[model samples]
Target: MSGRLQHKVAIVTGSGSGIGLESSLLFASEGANVVLADVNLPSAQKGADLIKDRYPTVKGIAVKCDVGKEEDVKAVVDLAVREFGRLDVMFNNAGIMHPEDDNALNTEDRIWDLTMRINVKGVWWGSKYAVLAMRQNPTDEAKGLHVGGSIINTASFVAVVGSATPQIAYTASKGAVLTMSRELAMVHAREGIRVNSLCPGPLKTPLLMDFLNTDEKKQRRLVHLPMGRFGEAIEQAKAALFLASDESSYVTGTDFMVDGGLTNAYVTSIGEPTLPPPSSLI
Candidate 1:
């Protein structure tokens, strides 16, 4: 049987590792031509190679792209269109977090700027170029098939709720991303393009592992999460596939929370629990 993305073309940024990499591979496996774009050229190439090796008949290419840079973002989208003849989906997934500065007060100006540039501005640039490319394609009805594209931005549950330990800049930037996705979705609804944000709680990616390396940190973090476990990269990739594919054709301007119920439940106070007064005291 043909896959959901058969013959479609997609561009996934930060696809060298973690969720982006897994999603790129999945997209290719589902018959979409994938462009694996990342700042790390070797890693991006490796991801492309892996996909090509598995699916020899499918097309997969790697391009070095720093999403924060408008020029690089344009080049990535242009390359995808040039090589594949069209762009069907764009995944804006490149992001960074500074380990040394977890709290707002302790974060330096440079760190704050870097996080915003990559996490917030990067999504804006990607959407700008992706929409431009999608516009070039004939309208769904005119093309004789429903073929307007989709844009998926990566956000985090921290954007929805405050974290016990603050990564203030990262959280704030992602919150902006969520809102941006909604606004862009509304603006482009009539154009037949869909925009949505995916919010993954805590995943077992290298970035998260680096922050929660110790047993003590793991225990502390687990208490806040009702699932008591870190999510896998593939899990996030599956969510991306839903948003990217026609499965979510009618779903746009919404936030998909892949948080394992962390955002839904409340944890008790870290050190103390509430108790009823003794009968004698009453």
Candidate 2:
């Protein structure tokens, strides 16, 4: 039996560790040739190697790409097309946050610049190149062809709702990403390409760990989460897979929140409001 993404080619940026890495592996396992692009070359290579090791039949390549750089973004897209014949999906997942600079006033200009460059401009560059690549293969199903593509950008729930302990720059960048997805979706809809953003809530990734290291901080975060637990990377990966695959063929120009009900629920806790269940739910 063939896989859902059999013979398709995909590029996942920031695929060194966390959601991007997991998504790359999942895409390869589902029979798509994958390009693992990251700022960290070794980490990206390791991710590619994991795919090659586990899915011997699948093809995987690692490219050192700083998504914020237009040249690097174009190169990664070009490599995907050059190696795999065509580009089917682009996951603009590279992002960064400065947890130490929680306050907007306290955050430095450099932190804001770096965050915007990677989180906001990076997504734009990825989409720009992806659009260019997808345009190369304009196919008409009426002509017995399907030559369109999908672009998935990583946003955060913080884009929609403010965080209690705010990283202003990160929030602002994601807000830009959220809007960019909508505008790009409309701009490229005529070309038969789909663009969407994935808004993941607090997940169990290294970025989260870096911020919420202490028991006190962890508890404070859990208080805002209705689920009362950090989400897994695989959970976000599954969301990415859906958006990347034909499963969400008609879904575009919207944000898919893999936020474990954190966005929808008003009340944080379910049981015993009078007494805090644990320090973990600070």
Which model scores highest in lDDT?
2
- Tens-place lDDT per residue, model 1, 161-269, is 9676668888889999999999999999988789999999888899888877788876766777777678999999999999988888899999999988889878733
Error of 1 at 267 (Å): 1.7
Model 2 clash pairs?
Answer: none
TM-score (C-alpha, index-matched) for candidate 2 = 0.92
List runs of model 2 lying over 4 Å from the truth. 138-145, 270-282
**Predicted structure with the largest TM-score when compared to the true one:** 2
lDDT for 198 (candidate 2): 96
Candidate 2 residue lDDT tens string, 145-191: 36778999999999998777668899999999999999999999888
Q: What is the TM-score of each candidate against the true structure?
A: 0.92, 0.92
Each candidate: RMSD:
3.3, 3.9
